[model samples]
Target: MNWMDSLFHELQTIPEVAGLAAADDTGTYIAGMNIDDTDEFAALLTFIGRSGLALEEHLGLDPLVYTSLSGKKIKLIVHRILDYFVGIRLSEKSSISKVEGRINSIVGNLDIEDE
Candidate 1:
């Protein structure tokens, strides 16, 4: 599978993680909220860096950047990490509407190039 698809599939293994990979309004809200938490944000950055390093090692790349195919994989992994964090924050129904609205606005402008 392509990197994005593989990353998405792996994310689906965790309930919280899966919700984020949906990339819908709900998912975006969860991601946004997760990033707002200092501890969660730090953990997320660490996870992304580790995932990126793994991908780079597997692909035998000397340097990683988002434009590179391996780097794209890293980017997707980071996105999912953010989503997972947001999903945890969204466990409460009370935050759903506001989170969904914010996520919708943010993701709406994102240009997801066709894979």
Candidate 2:
């Protein structure tokens, strides 16, 4: 199965998760659908982030499985979801400067350094 399908399946296993599959454009497109509030979104993001990190920790694991472009794409997608949630949380807390600092930190930490 594709990553999106795997994501949906993983979400389904979590009892707290709620929401249609990503393929459900009708459900996803509804006005103010509140995907943020849906437990599935939160759970799925957490799962992907944690699993990716775990995979990275294991030596001799198949690089093709965990370090491939597909794997990085999954991580990037999770990061984007986290960034979205961070924005919403910051809005609620009225902490734009705090969020900006966090984004800066993330970028600075991840940016390639000169050898």
Candidate 3:
């Protein structure tokens, strides 16, 4: 497996994640699961991540680590990790705090990319 694949696999171990995907800084789909249109999703993730960074800059706030949007049936959590962004889709009722810890753990242990 590639680096992104391994990381995504680890993320899949989280029980609450119904779907997940990753995008590079350029908004290209790196890897994903359960997402219908990987290209569109990746693009959306890039837009969201960029917008967050722009807003933080304007407000003089700390860089964004992650963000979430909740809907009636699903919750979308997006994390900016290194030069990539990962989006996790969870059931609306899932415990976000529980999943956040696991996400951080996986991201924290990310291996250095092969040179």
Candidate 4:
């Protein structure tokens, strides 16, 4: 399988990851699972990712690695990979630190631009 496919599969293997979706710079749904409205989700992910990048630029901070959002029922972790935005949805009880570390290890070992 391709790297993106492998990445998605690995992310889903995490027990707490309920679903994941990816979006391009244009906010188009590229891939995912268990997502109710992929188009909308893609748009949202793109918007949030771009906003984070812009915020970091405006503040003269380092590039944004990821962002997390926690709501009443679920938690979402969004990663900006080149021109793509990947959103990983987690169960409320999931350990964000552990998951993020795992994700970091998986992604760090691969050449993201090769995908």
Candidate 5:
């Protein structure tokens, strides 16, 4: 399997995840499923996640890891991977910790095209 495939596969195992997408820093979709507009959504998600950097600094939380947004029906998560960002959409009812650990395990091993 491709590097992205490994990441996506692990993400898929998460009980709550309904969609997954990986986008380069430039916001190009690399892999995913069920997202309405991968390109646009990736860009938006990238911006949102990166933006948290400033927020983290403001809040004095060093070393940003990931960011999650919970809505009434869904939970969205984004992680900054070297030169890309991974977006996951899941059912709000599920526990994020279950998938978070899996994600962390696979991210460092991902063999992407660039970096």
Candidate 6:
């Protein structure tokens, strides 16, 4: 498999992780795993990130860097890296701090890097 695929695999090895997805700054899909309707989901994630930034700008707060959405079944963790985004899906029972730590490492390893 390619490096991107390998990265996705590595991210999933984290306990309680259910899926992973990457999207461009514009919300276009880059890569993903274990997600049905990947494109739609990626686009939705992009919108959420963009909206968060808008909220930050409107409120004159620090630059928004991360986001989290949780449900009874799953939780979505999103990281913004300049013009790109990475999202990790985790089980509701998972420790968010643990998952975020794993995602931070994976995001650091991504070639895109954050600006």
lDDT of each: 0.36, 0.32, 0.84, 0.85, 0.77, 0.80
> What lDDT tens digits, residue by residue, belong to model 5 across residues 1-115?
3666778887787677888888776767777888888788888777877788778989998867788877786677888876677888877686676666776676666677653
What are the per-residue Cα lDDT tens digits for candidate 4 across 28-110? 99989999999999998999899998999999999899888887876888888767899988888887877888877776665
Give the per-residue lDDT digits (tens) of candidate 1, residues 1-115.
Answer: 1433444344344333213322322223222222334444445544555566578899998754321112321212232322232222223222333344444343333444533
Cα TM-score per model: 0.28, 0.28, 0.83, 0.89, 0.74, 0.78
Q: Model 4: which residue pairs collide? A: none
Better of 5 and 6 by lDDT: 6
What's each prediction's clash count?
Answer: 1, 0, 0, 0, 0, 0
Report the number of the highest-TM-score candidate. Answer: 4
In model 5, where is the ten-residue run with the lowest total lDDT?
106-115
- Model 2, TM vs. native: 0.28
Models ranked on lDDT: 4, 3, 6, 5, 1, 2
lDDT of 2 by residue, 1-115 (tens): 2333333443344332223222121122211122554455445544554555566677545421211112321211223221221111212323333344443344234423321
Which residue runs does candidate 2 get wrong by more than 4 Å? 1-37, 60-76, 80-115
Q: Supply the global lDDT for candidate 3.
A: 0.84
As for lDDT, the candidate ahead, 1 or 4, is 4
Please list the Cα RMSD from the true structure of every candidate, rounded to 1 decimal place.
14.0, 16.0, 2.0, 1.7, 3.0, 3.1
lDDT of prediction 1: 0.36
Reference-based lDDT, residue 14, model 2 = 31
Q: Give candidate 6 regions above 4 Å deviation.
A: 1-7, 109-115
Q: Tell me the lDDT of model 4 at 57.
A: 91
